[model samples]
Target chain A: MVSKLKTSLAALGLSTALATSMVSGAFAAAHETPLTGDLVIFSDMSNPAPRAVMEGMVARFKEMNPDLNIELTIIDREAYKTQIRNFLTANSPDVANWYAGNRMAPYVDAGLFEDISDVWEGDMSENLASTKGALTIDGKQYGVPYTYYQWGVYYRKDIYDQYGLSEPEDWETLKSNCQTLLDNGVKCFTIGTKFLWTAAGWFDYLNMRTNGFDYHMKLTAGEIPWTDEGVKKTFANWRELIDMGAYIDNHTAYSWQEALPFMLNGEAAAYLMGNFAVAPMREGGLTDDQLDYYQFPTITPDTPKGEDAPTDTFHIPSSAKNKENAKAFLKFVTSAENQTLINAGDALGQLPVNAQSSVDDDKFLKEGFDVLSNKAPGGIAQFFDRDAPAEMAKVAMEGFQEFMVRPDNIDRILDRLENARERIYK
Target chain B: MTQATLPDTHADRGKRSFWRRNQIAISPWLFLAPGVIFFLIYVIFPVFQSFQISTLRWDGLGDPEYIGLENYRELWDDPAFYVSLKNNVLWLLLYLLAIPAGLFIALFLNQTVTGIRLYKSLFFFPFVISQVVVGLVFTWFYDPTFGLLNVMLGWFGLGPINVLGDPTYVTYGIIAAGLWPQTAYCMILYLTGLNGVNPEQIEAGRLDNARGWRMLWHIIIPQLKPATFIAFVVTIIGALRSFDLISVMTNGGPFGESRVLSFYMFEVALSEYGFRMGYGAAIAVVLFLIMLIFIAYFLWSMYRETRGR
Candidate 1:
């Protein structure tokens, strides 16, 4: 880290700071120039591993095109969410990191994101085709996905063995597994709903399983009413688990990260969480033999499986000064070789978006990639928050949290959500 | 020679003398300008702007469409709004307990005992710590799984109460956390008030057979009126603007049961899932009005007190 900073600082001093950002004005006078111009990229790869990946990608990109001097600024992830709004309209970087699906709707609608349909055309379409639907708003692709991960019941294989249980293939077996775990004084599931979105994950999988992907999509899209019979049945299924005390006690007090200790300590058997959780669980001393993954089991017969796989993407702001270099940078990012390198197990530990890219030979990564690509025939949801508009997601997720605490308040909660849906959709 | 080139006329003389003539009146304004301008720009204008924005139907990213109080109209039917308002009321009523609590602590500690300064600082410790730190400490203290609170309760075989997680107990739990700092603040105020208490009056009251409750009510209490007034004003304002403890402890959770108006305003406008600037502005406006009522009453009482004097 110290050496990297020294080199960057040395580069600045050698060029009198004119070789990079300051020379952008010079590029404007020429109109058409070499790839030698400045390319500013604002990214939210703030965590240590992702930070290394971002810095590594930049170093590699710089090496390929020695003429280009790219300026990278990494913001803290939480701050980046709000700062993206300000910087997009005012001081835009050439490229920025944002999420996929309806999460980017506001920026897309406000004309902040540059339409990159041309980038996605031809061979590019087939390469990054998996996340194209996620980045597209109103039939126009706005961004390209770098990596994504699957969401499922990440469980302790060791705990299952102790209980003499196998991976559940159906809702009946899933419940019986939960019941056995509960009988042995273990929480069947560990979830933290304090932030409210974790509860939304349960709703997403349950609703998708009970009804179907299309129904779930329409419901989030505000076409299906909250009080619909299908929605009620999903909640009914959820209520059964709640009634059984399957989730950890006082879950509302813990963040998703804080709830990991339950599974780590064997107080809980499993967590219905995103694949990102594997890193922490592994860090908490669970060996590969101890940890395992399974697709959330079926509820209604013949219901096609659906999975939550949120994609993180990069985009060019519409008002960005250096569009040419930005496009080249993005192309480099989505290239098969680069995707494989950046999304490798030692780096992001996530599934690569590029279909042509090689999946890393890690057990969880391979299973996640397989589950997302093949097992989820119904469709891939971007998550409840990303699938629905932000306002509706917040209100609905809060309702989901309330329902978890008070199962009997389901009718009142449905009515409240129904009311919100009318107004939010309007 | 330096003055030789100066214009010598009635108008020139008047111009030169104008600053000198108006210095007393204008100098105060010059001092006040920076503060007043900042106050107007930062505080007063934003309050008015919130009112204007509340009348719109816009997210922060797009052009705010003037929806003519539709935001407020929505808030009228909104259950979350009522929950926030109800919590605000609960905060106001419960937060006032600090005054009496602080007074008692202050009175008890108003002694010349050994290591008295140490004891006073110990009592004043909660106020000195940052609210965020206090909130974090209380969160762990109230943790249902392995918190000190539940462990202590286990000794009595009482409870494993998830104070921050249960709707019935969440708001009160946060309020209790808030009271830790607030009572210290009130204690400090009363401590200072106790310093200026008249020894002669206490002696005179003792001679008149006024002791214990009677002496406190007649002599000591009236003397602490100034401190009491300041404490009342600050505590009320603090209670109305309660956000940090609620935010740090719960983020308005156990299903939005712990949200005060400010936290709700922030949640609706700024939180990741929240983007309805218009709705947030409406919440801000409502919170502002609630604050304005107490401010007006306090200002009116001060005016009446001064007039009577």
Candidate 2:
């Protein structure tokens, strides 16, 4: 028995010595490199291409740091929206995929997300200067943006060529273009409001163009009432489009994807959509030369031009266990080289957020980059949903959709939205 | 003295042996304890917890604040709430049509033909699939551009109707989709009930010159009371709980025109609107009360039937 105890004690001592050496080895490696721990990421990139891109990124990340471990749990988009709130508080992952702007406010306000300002101290701060404002809340940065895309009019260049029409520069030209398109037996615009947010794109552009960016911001922040005259003016402009039969008939029955055929078949002259719609349009047999990108026609000539640019961002959770590794991952992922790698991938059609990052020499990207990078009077507004609080955004979108369906009920819809705004802001 | 002592000892023995003699009765309760505990935890306890949650103001993430009856008061003023309530009434009224429709289908298919079994299985196919899938299939069928319904209507020069988009017709469209599966479920129940019908009574009614409607009313219908009772109960519950179809097809859209209580509760609690858990709980409590009234009546009727038997 004594001999057995001595043998066990020796074994224990040897194991402890080995463990100590391993710990020292890891610490030495950590000093040399910032990546040496397990990182868990919860992503909502459920689409096939985005999922593939994410998987590829993870593989490349693994190659960069052989010792670092990554656990990516990609969830469906709709499910992720609800599940994030639960997981962030109860079982937070080291990193999470989210949107920028007001969409990130609730989580940031609740302290569920970590402030990664130190990550933004050097190269990142310079590389991603344009996106810095979006991730900042209360003068503290909470996330890092990777990519964003511009929303604008994707018109049939061939149709415009056939009619000898130049891209509209202002509201009068836009109305005349619609008349020309209508006279030529083609719809002026095609949209699918079945998902509701598509209507918000129209509302965003109209409101920003008419009232400028400050008023749009104030309106979405619930500082301004929905019944405000500026809001009324925006609707009146939208009503002009409806009056001129700008959109396709029965648009509410189709999703944005389902509405693509109208533009592809030349039944509709243009689609006001994001850059992501370009690939689909090409796939549907519209050649690159046949389609051209243009900003939404100027509604009010002197109103500073505000464009919708929805940004996708990454953040570290406050309850993250491998925070150091997460920071390392964020830095690695948001690097100019890595951002270029993601931009080049087929999963995303959006431009890299890092100003220094290179993108594929694609035509639409060049046009979007030019338009978005230009000094517009009003600057950029994230899409309506991202700009406004989630509750207000939902009600606003519904109201917008209802207005599209029946423009006469604008008063009732605005009244309802005002009630919701008061209640939600209260 | 011995006799008196014996009588007292016998009484003491009787008292001690009572539980021992009733072990069979006690064992059943012991067996039921686990199920009862689970039911209380999962079903009964949550009902009361939701009621308590309704009196508070919570976002499901932050600390809950007590604001008694405010949520209910908000519900009173909410136009969306009224829309949901009105739609629910429409659903209840229209959803009942499935019962008679199911009986009609069951009676038509109640035959011993060579492929009748196959036919019955095919008829039951919709109920077997998930309602989510049914909603999708119906949504595609109602699509304005390429839907089969539109294509067919095109032939008649009648419609390219936006069935799921227009507020006036959206609820009816959803109800029609719901009825597809619900009718199939009811048909199966009636089919089983029909198999247990008394042949002797049927023959007696036939001999007395009763046939068709008369025969079915006096003989078959009376005997199908249990099946009808179960069908009504399930259909009512199903109508009240019609969330999946509405969620999949409309998501209470085209201006929240087709809102139902179950869908509204989910929208309020979960969705991108952020979690107004207390408000959602209040909506849930109202739905629960509505369901409770029907359930109470069902239980009372069931008790009466058993007591009379």
Candidate 3:
């Protein structure tokens, strides 16, 4: 009787399992389509704007070359860095999105990316020149710049005007405006350093203002000592701001979006964020007329300031089978008409790299160009995290947080960063 | 004529013996082949490959240059490695508290009530969700100004503390997040064990005047050993292999204060950090070896138990 019961129970479990699998199998079969081959495109920009651009690109490319097939894989933006690294090593996609900077160094050094300099020269030559030197590793162009935007202090013009404040042209004026804002019971600044990357903008503004272009480049390249006078001065200024109660409290718990509410409620005066933040500003119920941008105040009168925008790019993986088709697709996307379409979407407020590309009619694009065009000749990209290695970026940002919350730990903070830098660079 | 007949019979016997031996030898292998092949390919092969990769300096591409034990040497001096290792130990030690705590909750909820079954499933919900979702929920729960925890604390007139900000409390905070799901897992295991408890044994203990803690120590606790063992096994593995919670919650932050070995390894080998794959592998090897020691202890104890049985 016991044996018979055991057999019956086992039969019951097997049938249930089989029933579930068959149900799911039928669901899967409904979506199945025959394909000769698969190409996967990995990217971090699955936010609506970039996603639409990518989908359109894929559709156009597929239509142009009906014989070729591709699969577009959108990785979460936050997790993309780590996930794509694993994918590239184990099962690389045909083409993938990546940032340009020392960020791309490891992949380039490993030869994970296929060199597409020839493609750029032959087909996309004019588009390549517009990016200047942004996408080059050594002398070769490894990827095509898709879109990029300027970074600056985005503030409420209405609040500034009500307080009789004009956009500050120099450091002293900026500090005074901050004080004025604080005096009015509004937080002078709002920022979220939860990920530690936001602090890079602050460091960039200060370093660019104090040390100028060459030193800024060298500092980011890890060629200069972070403890050097120029770097220290930037930290000292940051400390001054912290001491004045200038920044928002509990920044560690807040993400950039969380900080938005404080600004929207008029509890905060300004947010030093990227151009993409403008869309959210509008989304958060701020009118277009209420928003404005200003260069982070110039610290040194003689320093030349250039645009500190980070650009995104795409490259063919060394393992790609459709190299020729991929290059053609890349070339097609970078064409003036496609780029115009990409930027015209409010979600992607990228400054067109194409000289012929114009957004004279769009106020946001006009605002972006006005700021970027007047930037000092040797404007530097954001420093600290971007300049330092990723490991160092992690350590340095953590140190910045510690320093912010506990100002007395300056010695310990600097020492920790120095040690991390040595260990990583060595 | 008789000698020739004897030779033929001897040859026939030898041929028959050979056939029987060959069949006997191949039958056991045929039975073992599937599982052995799977274990080799999925588990053993990757481990050896990782070990081999750990010995060479490669950036996940290009030619791998042999750098023999330099990675291990670097790990000795790497401070982040130590921080992460220390945190992993903290996670393991503190994570064990889940088992007893889980049992306490399980025992309380073991009673029949109007909605007892629904309550049990609700209690077990944390275990069902992915850790990423759990991390996000706890991150909000621990948010300084707006988090539910702070709102609860506000009734006592305490300032909103940045649970994730302070390096001192960050790891503990993340561990608390981990404990949520881990406790749920243990609770389920204990509930099953409690259901299988012998009622006659309980009645006999009562006749002997045993009850409550005394009864638990002598009878109930001993009976729950199988569930307890499985819980311990899972908790230890989960604690040591913890990456997702740390990654999602802190990214090993407030200054690498929450760095765990697994995350630090990935950061070192591939992320924006240096491509020290060998160094990363050495860190992994250390983690693997630590796990091995625990596994050996578990195996030895199991071996003794099985032999005694």
**What would the per-residue lDDT of candidate 3 be over residues B244-303, giving only the tens digit for each residue?**
998888877876789899888877776655466777888878888899999998999899
**lDDT by residue for model 1 over B24-127, one digit each (tens)?**
69999999999999999999998889889899888888887888978888899988899999999999999999999999999999999999999999999999
Candidate DockQ scores, in order: 0.74, 0.63, 0.36
List the per-model TM-score of the A chain: 0.92, 0.91, 0.86
Write candidate 3's Cα lDDT for A86-202 as tens digits. Answer: 887788877889877767766788788888887666425554464646667788888887776778888988999989999999888988998999999888889987777787777
Shift of residue B200 alpha carbon in model 3, Å: 4.3
Report the C-alpha displacement of residue A310, candidate 2, in angstroms.
Answer: 1.0
TM-score per candidate: 0.93, 0.92, 0.85
| TM-score of candidate 2 relative to the true fold | 0.92
For candidate 3, what is the lDDT? 0.77
Tens digit of lDDT per residue, candidate 2, span A149-246?
A: 88999999999999988899988899898999999999999999888899999999999989898899899888999999999999999999998899
By lDDT, who's the top model here? 1
Give one digit per residue, the lDDT tens place, for model 1 in A307-344: 89999999999999999788877877887666766787
Q: List residue ranges in candidate 2 displaced over 4 A.
A: A1-34, A345-347, B1-22
Badly placed stretches (over 4 Å) of model 1 are A1-34, B1-21
